[model samples]
Target: MILVPGLWLWRDPWLQWAAGCAGAIRAAGSQPVWFGYSRRVAWTAFLRPTGGTAAELVRRFLALYDRVRARHGPPSVIAHSFGTYLVTRALSDFEGARLRALILFGSIVSETFDWGTIVARGQVTPARMRNEVGAHAAIVRLAAALRRFGYPYGESGVTGFQLDELSRSVNVRYTGPWLADSALARYCRGVWVPLLRPTHPPRRSVLTLRSRELSRT
Candidate 1:
């Protein structure tokens, strides 16, 4: 699985998450190959430049698509938050970069369908997290348009952009609004990580991008 973390965090974060997930898969004796990417840009990367539109962001993302595909060799991707935009854009431009599945955690996809309006709505209240919002809504819409025909977006909307197109080869899993840090740490440190190692004698394992069960949080 190609693991991509949210912005500001190093690529290792997703590996950490995957490590936690590894325990679940290992219980079934599934050999998991976790992939990582440092290209995890900040949420703002999708936003418009002084004169650019969302299209510009897509163009740039497409330009970098090859590097990612070459590294992971068409992986089952897991993207959280803003990384969803990056994954969507990559898949839109390169059909051969087929994936097995896509798991989006706590996605900010709601903003992608109508970013301008979402921004405006937030402006009314002077929110603190405003700076994190970006051109993701626009990018997601563009990707959705390219990948499929009729997917729609809205508050509490079940249909998402680009997901159906992906479903042809990649199963799309959505686990949004995930319980915040407390839940995450519990899943990570408490459960996933512990189950991966030899239990009789506790030992510290060398953590790598390779498939291995990891602790969470």
Candidate 2:
């Protein structure tokens, strides 16, 4: 699975939402790998700074995630809204890029996104990393006010993911208008087909220390 779409989506009627999340990950049998954008990306080239085009879509999403992990071993991403900042900068600036699960929606990255060095270098696993927040997402609040002119973007889909530690990574808030095609088919059949189910099971541990009375500010 790997959908990754967002931006003008070449208008013409809109609401593809990664082809309705690639038809709900092909009716939950998986095999998606969508990833478009060879052209037609205008919202003024998604708010300027297009010289590299977000590092050439993070080098074509790490060359289609290493040619689909050299034939299906580690592909599971959902991404939206500038493809969730190009899949969090290709899993935080690449290095043996791996992913067995991740889902974001209408995100614009930068809520101080280190994710503790992408969860201490395992690529993805804070219980498989989901983030679907949408507190009245006005284009992620104009990409958090264009991040004060430097423009990397923020608001974490509007006030989620301010991680400091102990992040289970499942933000999941919603209200409306996150490009709603019935809220992306009810979050693609109730939260990304049961979290990219191959019999689910990803509740990892070990990164502690975020208790400040369960903080959120």
Highest-lDDT candidate: 2
Kindly list the per-residue Cα lDDT of model 2 for residues 1-217, writing each as its tens digit: 8777767644521355566667767876667877777445534446763457667777888998999888766888877777788788777778679788888877888777888787788888877777878743787888779878887878787677877556845676865344546467666766677776655553433343355435653
lDDT of model 2 at residue 13?
Answer: 19
What are the runs in model 2 whose C-alpha is more than 4 Å off?
1-48, 60-66, 78-83, 87-102, 109-131, 135-139, 142-144, 147-193, 198-217
Error of 2 at 55 (Å): 3.9
Task: Give Cα-based local distance difference scores for all models.
Answer: 0.39, 0.72
RMSD of model 2 against the true structure: 17.3
lDDT of 2: 0.72
TM-score of each: 0.39, 0.30
Instruction: Quote the lDDT for 74 in model 2.
Output: 81
Error of 1 at 90 (Å): 0.6
Clashing pairs in 2: none
